[model samples]
Target: MKKILSVTGALLLSASSYAADLTIYTYDSFVSEWGPGPKLEKAFEAQCQCDMVFIAVDDGVSILNRLRIEKTKTKADVILGIDDALIEVARGEELVQPHGVTVTGLKQELNWSDADFIPFDYGYFSFIYDSQKITTPPTSLKALIESDAPVIYQDPRTSTPGQGLMLWVKRVYGDQSDTAWEQLAKHTVTVTKGWWEAYSMFLKGDADYVLSYNTSPAYHVVTENKTQYKAAEFSEGHVAQIEVAAITQASKNTPLAKAFLTFLISPEAQTIIATNNWMLPVVDGLTLPAVFAELITPKRIGFTPKEVAEQRQFWVREWRSAATR
Candidate 1:
């Protein structure tokens, strides 16, 4: 009897070890301890009864490049943390398939009609400042450019928020974007590779302001109980970023990948994403924490994915030339 029981236990352990893995590719910040990845993973695994694996890349753009490089050999069942800015690129590469889930009543600032990618969370890009440090924050892009206030931002080539800022400036200035960058370059203290490093520098008083989300102050208010941090409202209106997720066309686990996408929009997973990811939930009828209620809702401005894809390179080049000069 003892020998039989030992053999049965071994088989059980082997089966457990061989459970299917649902691999998700996302940005590095999404998987961090402070981000929504772990909690969402745990909740998803409970229902999936499979191993939930996350592969972190540097940013949304990197996620797209990596998927293209891997092609049909990709291990990614689903790709998360991609913002609306790159949706056209993903579609152009044919990296993702239609989710086939009928979504309705999304309460996001932007109307999402893409059948391939599903919106998970969204926010408006804005400059965050410490009230004690800068009493009068710039109310417009032109004002920020002309001000002597020290500012730190991320690079568009490497960061989503950085790309958003570039887009924001372009949208606000139009043909004069180069002129805007030339003036703004005077106040730029340093350009980091990613959002975390830049935001960290801002928190450490490395600069007077940092490019971040309008909802950023909610995290400090809810988690740290610090009310001094605030996102500045701009007259030019802020750029909206709608973060999304989709199943890769090459996913072997089609049903499982679809199931994970379904779970992503569920209330339980959304709540974790909203509070932890520091962004607004996409679904309707979900109550946010009181701290989130205190956040400033900016006038949102954005471009279609196709428009962004076409103009991004040109804007980046113009920005680079002006900033370097």
Candidate 2:
């Protein structure tokens, strides 16, 4: 039973690696200079006496797409960056294998239990607003969608946040979601291709709200020392996107891959991920910056991977038909 300290000396895992080369598939930004890739790669190499190669793809979904194309012929030993929403699709496609790690030291709120995928970092999808401009943010997801306040969000076709908003709407609105999308389109400033474009528009005061993460404010607070940006805390629980990793079926170095997975949840790596990725750690009790403590610790809500995988296309089509009308 590995409990997050407020106790002592918990979360212990043996680091074991083989001499074989291991290739990991992940998103582009994840392997960027500022991202956690270099640090994580160095740390793992120190413990695991093996060559760990990181293969880059466009985004989380792209990794799955590459797997779909390559299957057993793929060169990847481990795959990372596919979030909880896509895990079921990946599993259904048989792109990943079970890591067989005994899960412990996870935040209880996550309520996580999966044999194939290992959660690394997570963030709640949220609507961001500048406190300097809007004093009263919408109190809940329902209010935000219903109100005429100008809002900007991403397109579900290209952006993770866009897909997250789709899930949030479905989770909260259910059968009435079609009507909600129609309502949202009324005051929507514009839907951009990605999170950055929508956020850039919001920063220019083009809109009152932009779809983003609860951790968005922390970056402003910590880096710029400007705290006007804030994530709205909706009475309806927010949808979360948890980035996860799994062993590929083509992996020749299973032991090394599993070791790398275990290392990801370790305190050392969690600390790196939280700060660098601008997301919360999957495990508990890692020391993060003061701004992290200030971020909203909202109640988690939304569908499972299986639910999202099954209904994603349906919801995307739903958004496409109704969002601009």
Candidate 3:
């Protein structure tokens, strides 16, 4: 097992350029042509006059999984995509260390005071559909799960949105989640390993609805002037995913890592992330696009980070058994 993990870890470090002052590990979408990574990297480079690099992985979960495999020899100075649900899991594994950025100017609604993780952006996990095709949408999570509408979602074993759905069903259905998963699987077109795979399939008009963020439509409106995409606000509320960054326990560049984390919550970086990443900024006051106001703001409901960490494996096994039944 150690040899396998070592090989996997070595594969990640394959053929990189010069030694970067700071190496950030993040998701693939964040560094895409349309994502915030390029702009943020350029801006930070100009500010610090240092070579900063980003190593892109499949998704948020993939970042942590890589860290777990790499263990002590990780090349990542900071990991920037673990969501709120997995904070405890990361902390318990001792993969991350405290990010010493002051949380004074953040949005008060977040109520964040963790010494470890600093939130960069957040959004609600929602099922989105083309308004032109579906006139009437599901009013609640229950309705969506029970309806025969064909759906596409990520696998809970890999994607954060998929993990959110597991929590959502558990929160709403509780003891009946096994039944709910079986029913959902009935109409589920496919479960992919990552968010983009499922979202891309939905964009091809293969499914009626796709799991995504509530702010997803804002990107369509801003980038393409297309308003057909819309998120269905569930009556039962939503599971909020606050994407965060933390300095790795193995980092020797803690100062640079801390500076990068501090910059993440700043107005300049937050603006780029909000528009490009399609998520809400963690900072309080930033003049954003008018379309952002129109996005659905569902009531937040889910387990604490500690609770999620404790029972994640159990729920995952249940989901696996039930989803495949």
Candidate 4:
């Protein structure tokens, strides 16, 4: 009994000694059971002997707002789920600090000028159409503009996917983008704030198509076990969206934060993202989800973050005139 008690005491001391902890602030879904949340926490703790304390908050904007309110006094060691639209806002607020370790291996995937943030996953924006309602899907962006079927899209000023669709027009039609928007405006039945509202409306037969990611259909086919919706193969390709993660300036623990970022890009985490999150992994060796590995593969498109950041304001201004005019 004395020996057993001594061993137990030693084990408790060992566990207590290694309780390194770090905090991460990210979008709520990121930590959800259905998302990458639980898997990442377990992986980081096991491999690095660190406790990952996830500060689950509202969407990206809410995370940013909280960061803004707290500033340098904030609790999170890292922040994830900022997109091209929100990247500028993050940059403007000076919310992030660089990781001492290089965020390498993203070179072939994304083209960004700085190293302050790193992209983990990316996808193209396309129209998700219900096959039951529309037998022949629109083949190109132009076809959607001319289609008789009513369409509903998320609002560009507010939604990330909506901004992606707006950028899609700018890249595809260039100077003719306004004219394209003018045409698309005619066919729009509703303009929603986010994918949930718009996609929910689409599912209920409110609209024929919803503006969303190319991999959006993967969830329906793989997890939901149905093919009620499919992404259109556009002639001009689709608008690309790259989601990034970075350590926060307000962090109390930088080393553990960097480790978490490394783990996120690790093969284990990437595999989870591909299968569970329905997103393309940044690392090379991670296997894609079977449905995505089979029915859907990522489509290539040409655009850069510098270009995205540069023309974003102009695109929104023009889209407003064309769409709401």
For lDDT, the strongest prediction is: 3
Q: Which ten residues in a row have the lowest lDDT in candidate 1?
A: 1-10
Q: For residues 1-325, could you state the per-residue lDDT of candidate 1 as single tens digits?
A: 2332343334334334435998999988899999999999887676556898999987776787789899899999899977899888888889899987666557744567888998889999999999977788888877887888899998887788989999998888888888888787888999988888899999999999899899999999889989999999999898999999998989887677766776677777788999999999887667788888878887878787899888878877887898889
Q: For model 4, state the Cα shift of residue 223 in Å.
A: 1.5
lDDT of 2 by residue, 176-201 (tens): 89999999999999988766667778
Q: lDDT of model 3 at residue 88?
A: 94
Model 3 worst lDDT window (10 residues) = 9-18
List lDDT for all candidates, in order.
0.84, 0.84, 0.88, 0.72
What is the total number of backbone clashes in candidate 3? 0
Best by TM-score: 3
Off-target runs (Cα >4 Å) in candidate 1 are: 1-19
Off by over 4 Å in 4: 1-21, 48-70, 84-89, 103-114, 295-299
TM-score of 3: 0.93
RMSD of 1: 7.5
Using Cα atoms with residue i matched to residue i, what is each candidate's TM-score against the true structure?
0.91, 0.86, 0.93, 0.81
Spell out the clash pairs found in candidate 2: none
Candidate with more favorable, higher lDDT: 2 or 4: 2
lDDT of 1: 0.84
Off by over 4 Å in 3: 1-20
